[model samples]
Target chain A: MTKVKDIGEQGLLERLQRFCPPDVIGDDAAVLVTDPEQSLVVTTDMLVDGVHFSNATTSPEDAGWRAAAANLSDLAAMGATPLGITVALGLPGDLSVNWVESLYQGMTECLQQYHTPIVGGDVVRSPITSLSITAFGQVHPNRIIRRGAAQVGDAIVVTGVHGASHAGLKLLLDPQIGKHLTTTEQAALIKAHQRPQPRLDVLPHLWKILDNSKFKIQNSKLRINNSPSPQSPVPSPQSLTPVAGMDSSDGLADAVLQICRASGVGAVLESSQIPLPTAFDHWLTSEQALNYALYGGEDFELVLCLPPEAAKTLVQQLGQDAAIIGSITSDTKVLLHHQNQKIPDQVLNLSQGFQHFSP
Target chain B: MTKVKDIGEQGLLERLQRFCPPDVIGDDAAVLVTDPEQSLVVTTDMLVDGVHFSNATTSPEDAGWRAAAANLSDLAAMGATPLGITVALGLPGDLSVNWVESLYQGMTECLQQYHTPIVGGDVVRSPITSLSITAFGQVHPNRIIRRGAAQVGDAIVVTGVHGASHAGLKLLLDPQIGKHLTTTEQAALIKAHQRPQPRLDVLPHLWKILDNSKFKIQNSKLRINNSPSPQSPVPSPQSLTPVAGMDSSDGLADAVLQICRASGVGAVLESSQIPLPTAFDHWLTSEQALNYALYGGEDFELVLCLPPEAAKTLVQQLGQDAAIIGSITSDTKVLLHHQNQKIPDQVLNLSQGFQHFSP
Candidate 1:
């Protein structure tokens, strides 16, 4: 069988070099810059093949899309304008050339959708395939957002729907579950888990807020490429920011707890206010759906802490895509307030999410 | 047994938060900036646990040092000024907290030595430990070097000692054979393998060459901040770049081959001029030593092709820290010329280095 050893390092790089960002592949380092007023925003993420995605359930392309999304979401959380990305890959010797090419095609799709390009990278062999992506972006220094600045009375609003990725994972892990839902529902759930849409579309709004000037994406030259990703939802332009900002990948409750701990404040979740996927009722009860929305991970939706007026305005602008799920308080605990007729209120002593080290 | 799940994501972050750069840990992304005259230069590298370093031979800190060195060396190859780094880590669930702490300590030592602090990153669970570091630096846009730009008659120069890491790896892999070596030889070899210095000290000289004007690190006010890294040589204040620049991670000959292939030229190495490690005489003949010097990997040294005048000036300024290794030629094949009485000259058919995917 042909192996990476046969192709050699340079051979493989040559195969993939055309996909690299222009003016990047052949240099010791990629070069980039922005206006002096903008600070460079950077973050990185790594995804292990087995731990983050199984080959049986996820195509190489989906893995690449998700890897780029993870880093892009971090930049989106800061209202940063994405500039470029560098991908470092660890791959198995037996990995086929086509698989890698497809993977990069997926990355290209996401980067084009977001308007950022791949800069430069290193590829080496490992026992299994894994990916590490570093995303660089730009933001006005004073306009940057952080998770530790949420005010006690800020209203917590989230972008987009939740629990779809969790449902998708459940289906991917068990094909038998596919019998319980329609083909459309199954496809939607699978897509949600495989693809994540970063909140970068909100940047134009963020600019408007930070600059205290009326701004509209339609009025600006910045094009909103509305081409929906196979793994993500269709685009909607509603966006806003508050005292603090966080992109939820570790589930809703855990994110609340994280913000509370970071800001030394408490949080209260209105369980009834949390949005549930419409088809979740087909296989899951309303209560179970809320639980999945609460504790399931990989949402990529943003949870923002804003004043009551800002939160209300953002929700109005976002229409039904978002809801005010919670509020901050001076108390030092995160609690859930369930007003639903089907569920009882509970003072959540624990807000757990995806555990990286969980067996 | 405590799992990473036991500590929870936030708990793990808390353990690492103290080591983060200022205003970096709590944010969605870290912010950095360089003056308008300079462009941001970025590079990334990944170290798989078993592939790059094994726990059997490398301590957590050594692995950390090596990982950071890989990326830092890329920036150094571009003559970029260090600014910050983001390290994404993938770790096994069974890893100890102490191991992680110690690893960060090693990264801290390397970054402090290079004056690049940790900015931001994500830590996730994987089957084994793997680290991905993103190094961000600043460089004058007009002066940046590329491997494809080497002139046919340019003189090639290399910095620091070569093949020591290879000798060190040999010792590390076989302790039984190591018993034959002197203690001084053993220590030096092991040190070379375990600790890699990124060569940031040579930056001032690089600045001088690139700008065509004298520049001193002391005048920048960026702060040297070096407490001395165990793996790095003492401050020598010497470095340079030319029309083409590449770091020697894949042995001298392989790097030369890469430059030749990129620049559409050839190279000729003067075997008599190449430097050998001090311990070569203890275990092998001069021929074997020279082979290692030519074909061993992880030297973390830079090989550059400069105009004759620039090469002469840089060599004079750099003194013994660098040497004129060879010259680029119009011919396409890389050749080695040896006039030494100990060995006959040989045409290198395969100037192979450590192959990442070799079976």
Candidate 2:
């Protein structure tokens, strides 16, 4: 019957620290001793209750899972290996201890599965509930993927299904729309929205392609040399690296534009080439489905550019779930290329995200 | 004038990056290549509007100063050196670009003055404006300080003024409280509340003291036999170390209670030994002034345990600015002694802080 307030902030921290791994909490700051050769990668993301998740519709566990996943996905996009995560939570006084504990449990589920430890954190009294997670990771100098390295002739590739989370979000927000889907279908969509996976497993292949591409002028040379030689240290024959990459948090089109803007190149995305959610046709019109695939956001899928052969090999190794979505170009404009002629329309729309300060 | 919405999230980041120095703001995460000899020390803190600071009473710069100082004080408590910081901001729309820019300027003034780079960050749209900062530091394993290391015989030392900020907060909330004070006194109190300087500079002296103390925890076992021998290296004749440590973010009594709980030791605080602002007596009784010194928070001053000789040396080195306020004891309760008697009452109240989840 101990309320968080009853014990006080320090008491609550002591209680939480009892369950957390020893040496991680109860210090001014957690200490991490890492490999000297590796570079530390850090990314931060903030999730506000009403903005990122609806407390009425989502459990604390789900909210925690989603927030951690968002930052983890950023690391995965950079081909970085997870190290530790530091969280800062601002909470309302009325929140239950059970809710906060469940939230930590959800974050631990994802972070532990990936070997990322929860190191240290701060909790403050806030009128509105909010959490900010700063995730630490490590990536080899040469293996680090950037959004600006795509070449003009490289092929665009993406992993996993796109827009399922968007579909799931719509269903979660509107039970009326979800009523049309089968119970199993509804559950799958809801799961996508609640627990999108970070693509930590796909880094090896992505790094290989980048190593082979050898744009050494723009990149720090990796420990592995991928030049044509008997000693050529290609990680795997099927595991190819991409020229450039980023995660699709703001949908495929927006991610592509980010790559283009960074690389000083344009892109040509084929609508037919994109792998949309299987239940898209059952839920909406073709245009709406396309919109979701191109600009719906929160897929957590990495989008990268590879040589045609390397892209094909990557797709083959990653299975039918991964596919070639498009190609890089010199036009400096991102265009949606459907059947035959170019669609002459911007692939990414300005109205895609839950714009925080929308007028 | 370009509103933040015009650039959108990505565009605003780009605009900010233009002035934020190269390699600080463009990546998914910044890569920190640090010295291998030191351990990575990380701490995170968040400031919420209406919770930590108010848009009505506080300027963005003052809010920035307090937030940065809080995290910096934590690092200083551990005798760690500042490395860099990553910020995650959650902002409502209709917030002026000018306001946000000024906020950054304030943060930059503090961080840059300390040579701690503003490394990487994320900006998100939220219904309420808030900011979370994760700061990185490095500390030597041999010199690492902990709150639980206080010994029974040690002088409790603290740097800088106390209760001034609390008085300043009171004045900020209600201007009428300042009517009796001279303009100089009012300005001093207001400045104390607005800008609590982080004690990062005091770290060198602390580390030297700890190194001299040479409890020889791990490395000593590796080198020194710890038995009476000529081979044993006791560091210095004059430079001595404190027994344990922490910063006073939550006032002296609470901090003393925390050290007691952590170290399984108690403390004896003589009211006569306590220091107060000179103007305090003119405005309030001696009891009220003592209460403010013992219970007022956010001083960002360090409260550490030291030997009498070392405390003298520190006071001499730091001038009259540093004071030996109390001592550690075998008794397992914190006692506030006045004249010759220990006050038989709770030294600290549980309801003191801005307790979140309070019923």
Candidate 3:
């Protein structure tokens, strides 16, 4: 066996160096040239073999997509436009070139959809396959939305229906679940589990909706310029900011609690108001549906709080895609309202989430 | 063993979510807020156990420093100001938390020197230890330099002395080499081999010298800037640019050839003009010195081409540290000039630099 020292550091870097294009390969960092005025957004996600994906069930392509999507969804959740990404891949000795190419193909396809480019990365030999992706995006500086900004009395909105991914995962892990579903249905669910689509389409219109809300929130804050089509005045940092926001990667209920904790507030979620996929109902009971809606992880949807005055315009702007699932409250607790009865707050404590070491 | 599926995807994400502070951890990526007007620069480096470091010789702290330095040097080479970093670590099942903390401490100490924060990262179990760091810096977009900008008639400039790292490695791997040196000298060489300091201080002054050309050359189009200043103007898109420019990670000779290939040009490097550490002469023969300087990797110094007009100012700015090591020629070959004789060109057909796949 060739020991690592045999190749040396220079030799290792040179071999991996050829895998990257020179334009962005060797610099201190790869440059993603965006319009100077835009705010650069960045996010990173890591995947470990056997922890995030199983070699028994997942192809290398699926593993790559899951790894990339996990990071890309973070960009989508912030409503930031995709820019560029760097991949850090760890491969075992038995890994083949074909596996790496397939993985790259999956990553490249996703990147192409969002117009993000793979600028540079590092490849190293490991005892097991591990992958980490750091993705970059650009958005207008003032328009860059954050998870901590959601407000009290604002409607909580989420993009896309939830729970199918969790259901698909269950089916993938237990073939018995697959026995009940039609072949096409099982395939659809499995695909959803493997390749979750990041919601990039909603980003461009996010700031516009927020701006319209600002006008409703405080009429005095709106200063319309007379030159040509006047633009809305830039809002002060303290005014009409998002009071509470989070991505529902850990299920809507878990994310809601996180937002509440960060903002020093509570929330009242209407159980009936939560969106569930039609396929989800076919697979699970109403209680299971509610459980999944509240706690199913990997939804990759945003759960946001907007002030009441801004809620109407925001909903109108988002159309049917965005839902009003709850409202932020002064009480420092997360409450689930089912019908007319209020259930005791039950917080889900995740011992580990998507971590490699915990299990 | 606790299977990863038991925790599930959302569960795993939620488990590790607490490691990231809410203020910086955005839904998509960790949002590191630096100076808003400055352009965000990004770089990544990955290290695997048995590949980049060995259990026999490297400590956890040394591994951490080397990993951070690898990425940090990329930033230093770009002339960008370091800001923050995210780390993704993969560990074996039996790995200890104490080991992880020590690694973090080493990384923290290095990053703290430049005031770079650990914004976020993910950790997972692997069969062997692996680490990946994605570092972010800020620079002016127009000032961001690239490798393909070297022009003809431009003087070639390198930062600091080369061969120290290669010699240091040789000494570390062969304990017999240490017999000739004092304890402190041996320790210094070992430390250099384990934890090389990236030249962050020289970046700010790089463009000043390159633009002025204190080094001598015949052609003027290829201007390589590896200094860490964010204010340098970006080369024009249409600029014929550097005949060739690269970081001396894989020996100066190999890097020069890379530049030659990139710019469709050739180079002639003078041996006596090249700088070398005094200690290196005793350990290595003149021929070995030449070979190390030519093909040895991991020096992390910048090799750049500049026009003749910029050579004087470049040397004046860099002072004694800068050397006019080589010049670009239209002949499309890399030649050595020694004792007033032209040595025959040597071809490095196989990528002779460091690779992650050897083991």
Candidate 4:
């Protein structure tokens, strides 16, 4: 009598974890220690035609790019450099060959950008178009980041702005909303929803910081490239090891909740400090923008927990590229606070994200 | 203006090969040489509802087993020892959780039997059920088998009987035809269709022969278990290497044609020498049975081309488990002949092999 809808996606995942080996199901990617120094990270994601995208909104090329990006983001979460990927496509007979070619073009372009190739694939017949992509990568056994490693008192940091993708999706579904904004603003939001960039670019900087002396850091600005130049003279800080890390593909709140639950810690997110898009004030109320930042999904940004000094140093190094959103706490429940006033968590409905099985 | 149906699956594959890098798309699995001695073999297969298996005919568990077996067979073809597999499932919201649990049970059983565990996966909502499984394995660089290595004068050998799975599928789709069969016969045919075993068991024996001295042998009987015991006195012959090898999932004729095309050689199949299931003659005519053996697909047996002496040795070692049904030729076309007469190649329609897009 228990249907998939009754338990939801999380429930299904928990069931699968119980059914499979303990080490197999918990991480963003399964880490198989292949050698003394290197471990294999493998992850698979399935994208259904109706569930993941629609023909009305997503072109074949964009769909292909989105699918590849999603899997690559998982590898980024594990701090793994991709080896390659295998794409298995189930296409309907009525689909045009040109569409398929365009799809391959999109997928190949995205993969090539990340220095990964499409190493193998299978194309089969189906009633609807679907794609299943499995990406494999290599990471040093000692350097692999895990979601369950966050420590109490660790400062929370996030790369890039949140909720733009969600806002972009809203604009795409309702063109009338775009009438209120300039074409450039509309286009930026739409691009965010259609093409998410995996945070692979930030890994090298993070590893450098992790390898050096511990340092304190804090957030100030927003923009990855706008950060202080590498040549800029900055004070050396002590080496800092990241307590935990993951990609924020789900809404920011969901990402925080997952890290907290996995690490057996709680968090207090400073609402005023959370990053929002530059265009948010152009057309939307501050409260609406805040809601989008908190609950909007598919940001594809990196979320990390580090010591206070490390956070400060990272903020200084990355400049506006990274922000200090919150801090980990020993308390069992996640909290949200705006400046000096504590916000009632129930009113925010922070638990709501882009759940697949929810009505 | 062309649709996928117009080009068909093979045409689509050829197009993909042209689009992808030369080294990435041509093998049973993509063989990535990671180290001097070891190579990684990765393959992916996607199965869709109705197209692959209908809910009316296939239980959820059997569907799971079939999907796993299909991917594992690809690994076996490459002579690789599986490391693990990742499965991505797209299920409808109305599907029962118990159905998914049963599906996992089936996949687990098949994977465990081959010593490969399920490592990671993603499940999402879809209008129809679909499964994509990616299996990765490791093989010795020097020992890997390829489809493009057949040589003239090599003997063509096949493992087990062919067409049983196709016949099984036929029976499952049309129960009226199976009514003439006994209860045991019905069950046997149904089992063949539902659970085709990957030929991983034969890999070690083939490797042993490939590793050892070359020996001449011939097939006289029909059962793998009926072969002479290892303790029996058998003369050792000179060493021989396998020229080419692959699994016969796409029917024996297609397998032969593919090897010939890849290896740039011709072949002559001995019609009378081909292996058929014991139950074939009981109800079906000679021509119908032969048709099933030649063009009916999903056999999941091994088709190998080896030198005469090596083939003889393998036949002796494998006994009734293998059959020598053909030989490699300098001629450019694959032909079928009976005892003395060359059967007109056109009459047999050798090109037809369970094509997906065909009307």
The true-versus-predicted C-alpha distance at residue B150 of model 3, in Å, is: 3.0
As a whole number from 0 to 100, the lDDT of residue A245 in candidate 4 is 82
DockQ, all models: 0.14, 0.14, 0.15, 0.54
Candidate 1 C-alpha lDDT tens digits along A177-221: 779788988998889999888888766654454344333322122
Please report, in order, the local distance difference test score of every candidate based on alpha carbons. 0.68, 0.68, 0.62, 0.78
Q: Show where candidate 3 strays beyond 4 Å.
A: A1-37, A178-185, A213-240, A312-321, A340-359, B1-41, B138-144, B211-244, B319-321, B340-359
Among all windows of ten consecutive residues in candidate 2 chain B, which has the lowest summed lDDT? B23-32
Candidate 2 lDDT over residue span A209-300, tens digit each? 44563433223332133332232233433232345788998787778888888777888888777887677768776677777777788899
Chain A alone, TM-score per model: 0.78, 0.78, 0.77, 0.87
Model 2, docking class = incorrect
Pick the DockQ winner. Answer: 4
Tens digit of lDDT per residue, candidate 4, span B56-115?
Answer: 888888888888888899898888889899989888889899998888888887888987
Expressed as tens digits, the lDDT of each residue in B220-309 for candidate 2 is 332232221232233332321234677888787677777777677888877667767888979967667766777788888888776666
What pairs collide in candidate 1? Answer: none
- Quote the positional error of residue B113 for candidate 2 in Å: 1.9
All candidates: TM-score: 0.76, 0.77, 0.78, 0.87
Q: For model 3, how does the per-residue alpha-carbon lDDT over B173-194 read when each residue is reduced to its tens digit?
A: 7889757666766776667667
Ranked candidates, highest DockQ first:
4, 3, 1, 2
